[model samples]
Target: MTEQNENGDFFLKYRNETLFNDKNSIVQCLKYFDKDNDQSLDLNEFEQLLKSLFSHNGNSYQIEMAKIKAMFDFFDSNKDGKIQLIELENFWFKIIKPTLFPKNALLIVDVQNDFITGTLSLTNCPSKHNGAEIVPIINNLIDTVPFETIAYSIDWHPADHSSFIENVNNRKLAENSPIKENIKTFDSVIYEAYPNVLQILWPAHCIQGTNGAKLHADLKQVDAKTDSLGRSVIYVYKGCLSDIDSYSAFFDNCRLNETSLHNDLKKLGITDLYICGIAADVCVAYTSMDALGLNYRVIYIQDGVRGVDSDNIKKQEINLVNNGALLIKSKDVYDMVGCKDRRPELAYATFLSLARSNKV
Candidate 1:
């Protein structure tokens, strides 16, 4: 390689290392990157400073420089070539302190194929809300939303699960001579899943090892790629037992057992939860309510969920609203996070726009 190319490669490599540094405390970072004793950072020093503050994995030099320039311009109030101590302080206060991206989590509930186009498809459901539609919206959210943790719940059930009406009818037939070929969906029956527990049967769905049990092909997991900003991807499996149903991601249908979801969120120190996914009236609603019961703030993305029953969906909305769940659309999420752009002025302006929007 030529001398000029080699010089460029060295600077790029140095920049990459600084960008991915896990060092805590802005003061320590400033001292380490500041090669000179001067308290102020010149364009080169400022570039290094900003890069260290944010994560940049394998970004091209041109792109990284462009982003650095935008951020420098945002903090450089006097347009002086150097960013002084005051500017550095302002950067920390405005950009870093206000947006602690890792305190929030995105929870997606039951976006499996069974809820979409499988035998128990929500499309064939009473509301006829296409569960597949949520895949793209949620995939987009997974990319754009700056959440610390991302969690998904899948309904994985045993073949002879008690919630299945087929199982119930068979049990009844064994007791009596015969019965109707099958009961309609949503019809209740007193079947003995437990000694005295009356189980409300549902259409057989999400059996383990079945196509219906898998998450949708289009649904993008937060950490599908190494470059994904999503810190962790947690999968919570529910309704796996043959004798019980599980609607809430955190607990079984009878609240007899709890999933690892609660402990995971607690371990991550998550304070706010943003939820979306299939069957808004059932799984989504149940999970949101459970989150509320745990004293965590909850926001339900209305456009990102479909429902099995239209009337039950309306009722669930009323119940959720009454019990303190913020109902919002997908577009409002940008404002909630105050924009992922590193430019402080633009981020503040976007936040102000949402403040005036009167939707929050």
Candidate 2:
């Protein structure tokens, strides 16, 4: 910030209020989000930026926002239903240190209903895992972290499509065509390309207005429609492609037309990303790997994560540590955010155009 001394000498001091000790991460996180040119970073811009960091196909504007109520539960440390700079910076320091927040801090992964319900789970073909442990941990984490911004990914599908078995059934009966459902009974099984369909077939779920598509009971909305604290949250839609699956919220995994989640994160000056969710071996794994690839420090909490156990979660954790990522637990998160936030301010341009009416 620009200031003058008693001798009328002007000089520069703190430029960014979002300052942290880490040169690679926290310090970089402050480079863009300090909006007021003040000497201390606040929560206003920080929270907003975290919500809208990912935009795939620029259609994020059309995404469903009903699931973002948890964002406020994380960022509003005071439990007063409102977030100010004081409330935000305080919790941030608490997470980085330990013994800083009024309580503890945490981050959550996908807890939506479509993935948790037995009928809605992607692996519906006889699987013991139902995304239960991951759901409760996410719920509990939200309560612990103050000023925590929540990012949820919803898998939306178009009304009429070849992705669903029902849709395929309808087409078979029409136009004097008969494509049987069973293996031997089929006249001809159309070899369609669906990267999401693993070798097995399961009932279609998350078809827009369907109940299975909503957030799970354990992951219920904070206050019906709005966030529990009445704060705004950002919603991102993934796996919109009828031809493929997008397990990772960061990208579609096809790597064809990627969104700027990294850039949005950089703009918000987020140094550390904590990831957890259902299908720890799939979506959660893919997202954590991608985040580290972008040079972001990450902590993957085992308690906050669940998986189909197809690939052994333990082995996956080892892979993460090998790639500059940390495999932590729910309890460890509290120590990480216990006391490591420093509030600095950045100087930026604020143009003001004033208009006055007077009679001369």
lDDT of 2 by residue, 253-284 (tens): 56654544555555545555678776677668
Score candidate 2 by TM-score against the native.
Answer: 0.53
TM-score of each: 0.63, 0.53
**Candidate 1 error regions (>4 Å):** 1-102, 170-182, 193-198, 339-360
- lDDT string for model 1 (16-62, tens) is 33442333344554565567967667778876544433322212122
Question: Among these predicted structures, which one has the highest TM-score?
Answer: 1
Task: Give Cα distance to truth, residue 288, candidate 1, Å.
Answer: 0.6
Q: How accurate locally is residue 101 in candidate 1, as Cα lDDT from 0 to 100?
A: 38
Instruction: Please state the error at residue 115 of candidate 2 in Å.
Output: 2.3
- Model 1: colliding residue pairs: none
